[model samples]
Target: MSKINKKSMGQFFTPPQIADRLVQLLEQQVGFALDLGCGRGQLGKSILKRFPLARYVGIEKDREHFNHCANLLTEQTIICADVLEEKALSLISDFMPVDTVVGNPPFLEIPISNHLVLEVKDAIPNFLSSGYKMRSEMLFFAKSLKQLKLGGQASFILPKTFFISEQYRYFREHIIDNFSNISLFELPSRIFSGAEVSTCILYFNYRKTKNQQLTLGCIDANGDIENYLKIDSAAAVTRMDFSYHRLMSESGIRIEESETIGSIGGLIHRGNMSRNELVRKSVPHFHTTSFPINEIEISLDDDVKDGIRFGQEGDILLARVGTRCLDRQVLVTAGKRAITDCIYTIKLPEADIDTVIASLSSKYGKLWRQINAKGSCAKYLTKESLLNMPLFN
Candidate 1:
C-alpha cells in the first residue's frame, strides 16, 4: 500500500487505459502470456479480462510489488526475482512456447554492477555485441523475443528514443531483421502521468522474414487510432528512415536525403574549457546565458591558453543543457571570448554560421533536432548528433 520508489526499482506501472489498449492489440486467442516486468499486475489484469482462460505468469523484482500482485491476483502465478538472471530464460521456457509476452519493461540504466552486466551479456550476446551499453528495457526485449514461440507476439511500451537513438541502432537493426508484423503505436502526449519521456507501444511477431513492411500508428490526444503508414523493413533500419517516420507521424513532415551541417564544412564540438580553471584565471567568460557575446577579457597565461575554449568572432554558440536554452542561438561577434563547457561552440565562418543558424532555428530544423535529442527531463544533443543534422540548401 506504500508508494513505490520508481527511481530505485525503475518500475513505472502502466495506466489502465494504456494497458487495455495494449491488450486489444494482441491476437484474440492467447494460450499463455508472460508479463516480463509486471509492476502490480495492471497489464496482467487487462490480459486476463480479454482472455479469461489464458495461463498467465507475472515476474516482479521488488518484494512489495510482488507481494501486492500475489495478494491481489491470486489466480495467476507471480514470481519474485530479477528477470535478467541467467536462469530466467530457462525458467520461463519451462512453461515452453509462450504465446504472448506483454508488459512495460523498466527503462532506466542499471547501476554499475559487473555481475548483473555479465549475466545479461551472457544471456543476450547478439543484442550486446554492438559494444554499445545495454539498457534494462533492451535486455527485456531480447529476452522476450527469445521466450516466444515462432508465431508468438510481443507488445511492449517503450521510450520513443528506442527507435532512433544512435546508441540503439544495433538493437533497431536486430528488431527489423528478426521480427515481423512490426507495428509502432506512438503516443505523442505523455501517457504515464509523471513520466517525462514520451512513449509508444510496439507490437511485433517473432517470425523473421526478409523485406517485411513495418506498420506505423499513432494515438491522438482523444485516443483515436489514426491511419497506419507502412514502411519497408530495409529502410526502417536506417537512421533517416526512423527520423522521417517520427516527423511524418508527429508533424506531417517528410525529410529527404540532403546535405547536413557536417557536409558543409561546419564543425560541432563541445566546449572543452574547465569551469574551475576559468574561475582561477579570473577571466570574463561566456556561459550559456551569456548571449550576443561581443566583448570579453581574458589572461593570456599558459594555463588559460591550454585549458579554456577560445572562440573567435563569427562563431555560433548553442546552449546544450535545457530545452529552452537549446533553442536559443547566440552569435559570437566583435571580440574574442572564452566559453564555458555548458555551451557547444560551433566553429564556422560568418556566412556558414548565419545559414546554419537560420536553418536550425526554422520549424523543420527544430523538429529534426527534437527528434534526435535524448534525455528525460532536459533533452540534449551530442556533438555528433548535432553535426549529423540535415542542413537545408
Candidate 2:
C-alpha cells in the first residue's frame, strides 16, 4: 500500500510483539475468537498460534491487508469487509457468543451515520452529537463487545483515547458496569512505525463485579510488562491512563474545582463556515492562524454564524483541534477577525476573561486538559467538553 493510502486509512499493521501482548491478555484458550479490523493478520496469527484448536475469524476492511492476512493466516477464516458496517456486525448471528475478541482497529474518524451506529443509537449512548462524529476504533471496540458472550474475554490494542479521553466516558462506564478483571497495558508512543500515536491494550472479562480492582501495566519494547499497579475501577473511571494517575500523585498537584467553564459565563461557540462560504459572502473570516489578535470586531454573517457567537473583544480564541496546538489559547486583541468552524470562540464576562485564561494556562488547567481532551494525535475538544470542564477556584 502507498504511504499516503495507509495514512489516509489510519492503517498501522500490528507488530508481532504487540500481537503477543494482545494474545497474552485473553484468558480463553479456544472457541469462537473474533478479530475485527485485523490488519495484516498479526493478531489472528498470534491467537491461533497459542490456541490451535480455536475457531478464528479475521475481518479486514483494506483488501490489500485482507489478502495479506488471508495468506498469512491460512488456517483461519479471513473476511474482507468494513467491520463498522451493520452488515459486518450482523454476522454476530453466525458467530454468536464469541469466547474472545481481539484486534488493532484503524485509527480514523468516521461519521455517526454508519448503519450500525444508527441502529443501536437508542441502545448505546455516545457523547458526541450530530456535528461531531465517532472515532472508528471506538466503534469497532463497541461492536466487538456487543458480540462478546457472558463470561467472554476481550483484549484490543486501542489508541490512547480509549484509555484517557473524556469523549468516550460512556465506554469506560460500560466496562465498569458490565465487565470485570479489567487491565490496561500502556504501550510506547512510537510502537507503530511512522506514527507517533500513543496506544494501550484493554483487557476485560465480560462479567460484572462490585468494587472490582483493575490492573494497570506497561509493556516495554520486549513485550514484557515492566511496570504494574492495581487500583479500584471507580477511581480510574474519570481518567484511566496510568501515566495521568501516576503523575497526578507523584507531582503532588492539588486541584480544586468549584464550577464548570459554562457555569462561569464562558459561553462556547464553534465556527460554522469555510473559505468557500467566505468567498461568496465577503465576510471577514479567521482560521486558527489569525493571531496576535488585538481587540477584534469581526463577526460571521448572521445566517452564516447560525446563531453562534463570535468575534468580540475580550473573547478567548482557542485552538479546538490539533495534537500540539489544541491546548493553545490567545487573548483576543484589539482588532477585527472572526472564526467560523472547528476552532472555538468564547465570549466571557470582561472581568472573568483574564482570570479564566490564566486558570486555563495554569498547572491545574493542563492537568484537566491532559485527560479531558479528545482524539489520539490531533486532539479535538468539543464545545460540550469545554463547557463541562471544571473551572478551578
Candidate 3:
C-alpha cells in the first residue's frame, strides 16, 4: 500500500519482528487462528512460517493488501471486506471453532451516534451501544472473539491504557465475564512503527468457562514480563473492595459519621473554559491535556482572580471528566490563569489550598484513580465520582 493510503486507513504495518513475537505467543495457544485487520498479512505470514500446517484466516478490509497475497500460505485464506459487514460473519463462521484470533485493529476517537468513522463500531459492539465510548485499538480483541468457538483463544496488541484506564472498566469487566484466562504484555511507547502509541499484547483464552478467574501480567516496554496478577471468579467485586480500602487507608481517614463533615459539592465547582481558547488566552489554564497537576510549573497564570476563575491562588483544581488518572484533584495556589472546563475548581473557606495540593501529590491521591476514568487517552473522572472523592477537611 502507498504511504498516503495506509496513513488514511490508520494502518501502521506491524514490523516483521513484532508480528513474529505476537504470532509466537498465539502459536503457543491454539492451532487455527484468525488474524483480524490483517494488513499486508505480516502477522498471518509469521503464523504460517512457524506453524506450517496452521489453519490461518487473514481478514483485511483493504483491497490492496488483500489482493496482493491471496495464496501466500499453505492453509491460509485471505478475505477482503469490511469486518463489520454482515457477510463477514458468515465467512468467519466457516472458520468456526477457531483456536486463536489475533490482530492490530485501527484506533480512533469515540463516536456520538451512527456518525462513526466507518465500520469501526463493529469492532466493539457493546461499547458504543451501552453509552460507553473511547478511543480504543483493542476493539479487535472484542470483535475477533465473536468469531471464536467456546473454548477458543485470542491475542492482540492494543493501546496500553486499557490496563489502567477507567473508561476501559467496562471493557475489562467484559473480558472478565467472557474469557477465563487473560494475560497482558505491556510494552513501552517505542515498540510500534510509525506510531508511538503505548500498547500491550493481550492473550485471551476463551474456554467453555463461565466467569472464570483471570491471570494478568504486566510487561515492560523492552518485553520483560513482571509477575502475573491473578483474579479469581470474584475478581471484579474483590477489586472494587480492595480499591476502596486502599484509597481510604492511604488517606488515613475512616468512613464514619463523625468523619463526614461536608460533601465536596459545597467547595468545588466544575471549572469551565475552553481548552484551545484557554491556551490562546493564557499559557497554562489548569488543563488536563497540558498540565495534569503532578508536573505543573508554579506560575501566576493559574491563579484565580476573584470568583470562579481558571488559575487562581488558593484554588484547588480537579479534573471532573477525562482519563481516569487525570481526574485527580489538583491545587493551584500560585498560578493566575483560569482552568479549562474539564477541570473543577475547589475554593474552600478559610482553608489551605496548598495543603490540598500537597495532599493530592501524595500516594493517597494517586490511589483514587478516578480522574483518569472516562476519556480514551485519559480516563475521565465523572462529576459524581469526583464529588465523592475522599478529601481531608
Candidate 4:
C-alpha cells in the first residue's frame, strides 16, 4: 500500500506489486528504459530493483515529486521537466538511445472546435471548456516514437478505450506498419485504485524487421498475464486468446474497413436530459438514468416541441449520461425527445438506421454491455468508444 499523491498528475501511483510485474514484463523486451511522467519513482525504482545493471532514467514535471525522487535516487537517473516541452525532450536524449519508454501519460482532454464544443458543453462539463483539440496520451506515444531508435521498444499503460476507439486508429495503423512487434497486456478495472478506468500495457518495438515475435498478455481482474502465443500463465492467470503469426492471422476473416459502423453512426447519441426536466416531463420525454430506466409519459397536452428537436424520424437514441445510459438502446422519432444531459441523439440515413439498430440490439450489443459498460458507475462513454466498436460486418 502507498499514500495517494493527490497533487501528482494523472492517476495514483501503481502499487509496488503491480509495478514489479509490469517491470518484469518490460525487461523481458528491453534492458535499458526511460519512465516518462514518472511520479514518486515507484516504477523506475522497480525496474532498477529487478535489473540492477540496467540503466533507468525518470522524468517528472512536478518539482515536489521530483524532489522526492531525487532524495532517494540511486542507480537510476531522475530529471524534472515536462516531456511535451522541447527542452525536456532535449535533456532526455542526452541519456538517449533509450531501449524502452514507459509510463501512464496524463489524461488531459483535447480541445475540439467550437461547434462541437458547444454541443458537448451542453451535455458534458468534464470536457475541457474549449474541448480537447489534441489527445494528450496519444501525443506521448508520438513523442516516444520520435525519441526511440529503430528497434527500440516503448510501453505504457493507457485507457483500454484507446485500443478500440476511432481516435487511436491512426496510431494503431502507423505502429502496425512501423513496429516489428506489438504486445498488449489488457488490465481490467478491478486492478487499480478507486478509478474504474480500465487500462492496458502496450509494448511495441520501433524497428521494422521480418519474423518478429508478437506476444500478448490478456490480463483479467487479477494481475494475471496469460501469454496466448507462449502457453504460459502467471499467478492470477485467466483464459488467454491470441495466435503468433503475421499481421492478419488465418482466422479466415475479412472485414471491410469502409463498411464499419460506429455506434454513433448507427444512430446512437448521448442522452442529455436534466433531472428536473425529466421529472417534469417524465411521461412525454424518453429517458434513462443511473437508476433503472423509465418511459416518459406523454400527456394529451404534450407539445411537439418536447418530442424530437434535433433528430428526425428513425434516428437512434443512446443514453448520454455517464455509465447509466451505456448499452441502453432506443429509436428516435419526431415524437421521442430526450431530457437528460446524459442522452445523445444518433441519426443515420433512414434506410440504414433500422438495420444498424437491429445489429446493435443483438449479441454484439450484449457483448458491448458486458465488455465496455461500467455498470452503475459514472462512466462517460465518448462517441469515440461507441464509434470504434469491433465487429465482423
Leading candidate by lDDT = 2
Model 3 ranges off by over 4 Å? 1-8, 15-18, 27-29, 67-75, 89-94, 109-143, 158-171, 196-199, 208-212, 237-313, 317-344, 348-355, 363-393
Q: Using TM-score as the measure, which candidate wins?
A: 1
Q: Write the per-residue lDDT of candidate 1 for residues 144-244, one digit (tens) a residue.
A: 65677888888888877777666567667878777788888876545665566667888888778888788777765544576567788766776423445
Residue 316 miss distance in model 4 (angstroms): 8.2
RMSD of each: 4.9, 6.6, 6.4, 9.2
Better of 3 and 4 by TM-score: 3
| Candidate 2 lDDT tens digits, 83-112 | 766687665467776888887888888766
lDDT tens string, model 4, 1-393?
A: 223455134545666766776776663545677877787887777777877777778888888888887776665788999876657767866777677777777655554455544433332233343234755565565565555666677767776655554444544445454665567676766566655666677777676654444566566554567544432222012211232111113322232333435633454544444657656754345555432344311222234453433333566666554453466665544454434566666667677765666655665553454454432247655565466544423
**Which sections of candidate 1 miss by over 4 Å?**
1-4, 87-94, 111-125, 130-133, 187-195, 218-228, 240-257, 273-283, 290-307, 349-351
By summed lDDT, which 10 consecutive residues of candidate 2 come out lowest?
Answer: 295-304
**Residue 272 CA error for candidate 1 (Å)?**
3.8
Off by over 4 Å in 4: 1-8, 27-31, 110-132, 190-194, 210-217, 226-273, 281-286, 289-325, 328-363, 369-377, 380-393
Q: What TM-score should be assigned to candidate 1?
A: 0.81
- Sorted by lDDT (best first), the order is 2, 1, 3, 4
The regions of model 2 sitting more than 4 angstroms off are 90-92, 119-132, 253-393
Model 1 accuracy (lDDT, Cα):
0.71
lDDT of 2: 0.73
